[model samples]
Target: MAVGRNGRFSGLLVVAGLLAGSWTGFGQEKKSEKVVVAGTPAAAPVPAAPADSVTDGSVTVGGQVIAYRAVAGTLTVGATATQDATIGFDGKTLPDAQVNSPDKDKPEDAPATARIFYTAYFKKDAAAEHRPVTFLYNGGPGSATMWLHMGSFGPKRVAIPDAEHQEGAPYAIVSNESSLLDVTDLVFIDAPGTGFSRIYGKDKEKAFWGTDQDAHAFERFIRRFLSKYDRWNSPKYLFGESYGTPRSAVLSADLQNVDLNGIILLSQILSFDNSVDGPKWNPGVDQAYALALPTYAATAFYHHKLPTQPAALEPFLAEVEQWALGEYMTALLQGSELPEAKRQEIATKLHGYTGLPVAYLLRANLRVAGGVFSKQLQTDEDTTTGRLDSRFKGPDLDPLSGDAEYDPQSQAISSAYTAAINDYMRKQLKYGEQQTYLPGAYSDPSFSWDLRHQAPGGPSATEQEGGTNVMPDLADTMKANPRMKVMLAGGYYDLATPYFEGKFEMHHLQIPQKLQSNISYHYYEAGHMVYVNEAVLKQFHADVAAFIKSTESGK
Candidate 1:
């Protein structure tokens, strides 16, 4: 989800378009957005609330909301440590390390000087010889890192509702059965303004948010965290979701520059443009539709709408690649010069390739937005439900309206999985009693974000043409760090990071074949956060375990 889009209720998040928004859940009309930083929109941002006075306010950490103290902060990146495998950072999610620990008095008056606080999860086991210590964080420029901390990673988690759809479910969140703690000693960091993490008040708005500042502050946090724990020599790894991908990626480079170890990119955003591009910036949706085609057909087949094809998603996408690149791209490039018959032919081909109706394709002027795909592909029953997964359908869609069909839930499976983590932190982790899970802060579910228009250039050109470009840097980073390994995980149904677009983005990456092998790609039947899909996640975990193992050391 882009930045803070998690704030809204996810309808069908397992599926891509099942949820209401795109990129960062801005929803349909805004498909033209340029995702410069994971799902975070560079141009359209969720305005930050005016900074409150940095008083002695406290939020739940270990338990009660005690007093808080403001201080000047310093963050620095440290060099990679070389050591014996005996120093095991516990695989446990650090218990609330908030400022008000029982050991010291909670600073009543804001501190006069700058101070930094660190929280850690510890495991008492002695087999510390060599371990993969992973630092985990979730997306959302404004989100607390708790999603991953409590969800699939932290040794402990939140207790979430069984079904998010169940009416009036107490903000149920719970301990996750699938935490990375089994293999990794995990650490979760809260960005400046969210969660229990706070910044200096006065002229102290500096450490709280945005890309550069965050990377800088987080670098400091890593330094503090490593020094505080004294495990500077452990083999380190980073795992992040949504915006955290960028955070992880940039930090991968940052840490490596300072001699850090490898990085694990979960739901990668190689470049902001590649990640956030809507229709204009990205036509990956069509390819996404293609990758999603068989799944759509299969889901329909399972739902008994389309032909029960024996073919699977891969072969279907293989055919789609041949056509999309040959016919679709050709058609798009033809513009007005293309003849009427060719347009109809392209539309017909697109319908078959995409499971969209030929008439809808033609009527859409040969272009169908992700929203249209969500709403149109349903069976003609007045009971037609559009899918957020876009690959999956729902019970009913407001046919009369021209917006997202199922929302990202029925579409976005991850929303539920990730949301559950929030509850997990409170209930299971037995921590953050005072803090609430800020799902997708920085997002306004009710606020209307205008869909952007074509900027008339290949990609938006910023001052240095540097804003929102991560893929190029990814390419450059790979060049700089020859041993680094990269993996791109995409869901066939993901409209956010369509399977084909991801492939296409990689196709255009400025890297060589040897370096390319350093990068790998995988696909699932789910959407962006395919990790939420039970079946897909099982496989994804297995695959990820293998990938991480290979990168860390030969098994």
Candidate 2:
């Protein structure tokens, strides 16, 4: 999930809208000519055929030259099987087109369709069955996969400051020595209505902009991709970051016919209730605060804000984690019934760990929210700590305000990413020459997210009144596919989805104790976008490569 310009958590909450006739040569028409027919309704527009631009490139990874074929393309997907049957891999309408197109004025008309965009890199002359293919995407629910494509595991990466705000460019786009191509083929996909992906047809927003609906779209896209590329026998894996983590859980469970080899989650948040963003709204649920404390302590330790400086970070964090889940949580649960002396004692400890004033902690009732912490952590210097990466700081937009106004980390490197993707897609990849790339889909005011979800073996269309939790989905997937492996990676400095929250959710999954062995965890010293740190990125590549090699068939 991404922190928006307004400092509100976006990614999951933000939705998207149709670009409404954007591309010229594509299936979307600029304007539909009105045709009046007697006793007949307008036929649903046929989706454009799949468009692809193939290019060959080579990158040196792990000190070996890897020649790869890159395909930048779009594949159309329907809202349902009936609509899907109308289109084929060759982009021709099937004989059953009339059966799929419903009356335009009918309430039961099909929802909007999407032409999902993706850039895939295949190892030259590799056997499909032997090569593991990993589908990678960034989560903004509304965000494009540009971050992962341009900043992380792709063949080329955008170079920016690790923890400082990058100044205006001529930003360098360099060969990624750590690209995952050495171990697995990579496909980076942009969500519908983001990047070159577009959605159109009836009730577009409601059709593709919800939890279940979005998962379904991705499911269709993956299936279609496998069929088109003849990779059904390949050992497949899903690599999702941020909001994409929950998407992976749901999608993994839904794709029961396909036995995935593994799932790699970066900066995960399977349970939204564990979010530290604005836990104050939910009052009695104190886990968010407790889960976030370790990250707060890590940030304080990094910034040298701790009252008594700890000699080492990891050991200090271990102590903080123990206190947070033990004494700190017990004190919070007491809530107004606790004696003033105990409250003072807890507040003092919080200050020592977080470097916030004891008076501030007392004023906050010891339940400081993530935004408030970001605002108050560096208040003495009039700086606002980044919610995504606390290591990055910026001048406070509102010094007197209780919450941070914007994310400094996002502002710091967004330009370099945007510039790099635009240049690279056009110049290197030879796609999107005539279209504009949308980094995210928050610009449209018509966008609205649907939080209702139907978990496996649960009632259908249940609104998550207490916030959406997909821990059950992951657990059910593991139970169904007992051999499937899972990898969890996160940054200690990420307050957006604290590293501890991922651990907490994974520990609480309803799977058997034996299945717990299928899961592995890795932590980095960086923030939400851990690859921003070159050192962490190198280690991340190694861990992921090793995980894939261990899990893939015939490895």
> In TM-score terms, which candidate is top?
2
Question: After best superposition, candidate 1 residue 508: deviation in angstroms?
Answer: 2.5
Model 1 TM-score (2 dp): 0.69
lDDT per residue, candidate 1, 478-537, as tens digits? 677777677777666555445565566677777887777776877877655565454565
The regions of model 2 sitting more than 4 angstroms off are: 1-50, 89-92, 96-111
User: What's model 2's overall lDDT?
Assistant: 0.83
Using lDDT, give the best candidate's number: 2
- Clash count (model 2, backbone only): 2
